[model samples]
Target: MKRFVVCKTCGARVSGLLDSPVALDFITKAEQELLSGGEYGNGDNGNVYISTSDKHHLSYHQDQNRLIGCCGPSPYGLPNLVCICKSEIGREVTDCCTAHYVMLYKERIAIREDNTGLLEKVVSLPVAEDLKSQYEILINFGEIEIVLNALKM
Candidate 1:
């Protein structure tokens, strides 16, 4: 079953759930380096990244003369990925290296079941008091560590 990645604040569909093998490989290597005492980002505040190649649902900003990637660092050196509502959702991290992925912060996005199953079955499920919370349940797509670490940050 497919899942949808949405903005937790406004319920805007950011993108569909998809796996990026290149990101997995990059994250694995980063984790190994961290385990070995190698430093990444600020001391003890290593930036956690979620890689995504999909940017069609997102908008980018320009700082000075350069166009900022969906999740790239802003002119202020902060993650610049913001929803239409101006909420900082994530950052484009592909510029950090040759990798083609965006580093999305988990806390900024909500994962919800696509509900593409039978309509009758979906409707029969108990209604959630807080629909947002219900959709916040993390679903593992072979990248649990990325979501976990993003939460830690």
Candidate 2:
């Protein structure tokens, strides 16, 4: 069974499940300043870091336009890869940056299951019941937890 990170608004595949997400602490001075005031930036926000070697998992927009801080030879800045619906999904940390990482916006992306069992279970459920109850059942007894646990590793 495989899973993927998808754009919540347009269902565009952002990346496959990260085999091993790495922690990054290599923000540049300019980026640090931008992170303080950019649209997706917030001082206290947390970021999911993926390696550049895993670039194959990510898909970029055809426009090739760079973001505010992402320009020049080093271009250590992030790229402007928006969803088909025009929503900013995630950013690719260019190789120029000291850390080879891709920072994804967690709130804008969803984890989707590619397995049949879970999809079958979801499709069989009645639509009348509250979604909360359905989610509870799925989390407590279905294969979702197993998949989630595997991602944690």
Candidate 3:
């Protein structure tokens, strides 16, 4: 079977034969132990970012339709993401602590049923003053870490 990245804008399969999709969903350090795939955000555009620092990193969309998977970093001073990576890859500063993705559903990631898939969930991010307080707690004390989030599809 072959794999390709479909443009949400044009619905085009943007991949060549070099595309090799990973079959496992990775976990990050900060999210809760139990999670599920769902919608999360401020009712606008949303993104999902995850970590597998132990192995790899993955990005997708909460829309349960879009995807943004990484193809590992570059070595030739270029990149090899090959498909959707073109749009989302360089968007991040090479050293930025965060990863970027379109955030999609579980079936899209296609984790195997044997080793267990990465769990995901959605939560409302409070607004105004409450949002500010939460931001303070989240960014304070050098506690910056990865969060697997659900966003508005």
| Best of the candidates, TM-score | 1
Candidate 1 residue lDDT tens string, 81-135:
6776667776654433334344455667765554443222322346662432233
Q: What lDDT score goes with residue 21 in model 1?
A: 20
Q: lDDT of all the models against the reference?
A: 0.44, 0.47, 0.25
- Which stretches of model 3 miss by more than 4 angstroms? 16-22, 28-153
Shift of residue 76 alpha carbon in model 2, Å: 8.0
Ranking, TM-score, top scorer first: 1, 2, 3
| Cα TM-score of candidate 1 | 0.47
RMSD of each: 13.0, 12.0, 18.8
lDDT of 1 at 104: 51
What ranges in model 1 sit over 4 Å off? 17-23, 27-52, 62-76, 117-153
Clashing pairs in 1: 71-91, 71-92, 72-92
For residues 52-130, what per-residue lDDT tens digits would candidate 3 score against the true structure?
A: 2111222321232122223322112322222233333211111222232223222122221111111111112445644
| Candidate 3: worst-modelled 10 consecutive residues by lDDT | 114-123
User: Per-prediction TM-score, please?
Assistant: 0.47, 0.43, 0.19
Looking at model 3, the pairs that clash are 36-120, 40-151, 60-102, 60-103, 60-104, 61-102, 61-103, 61-104, 62-103, 63-153
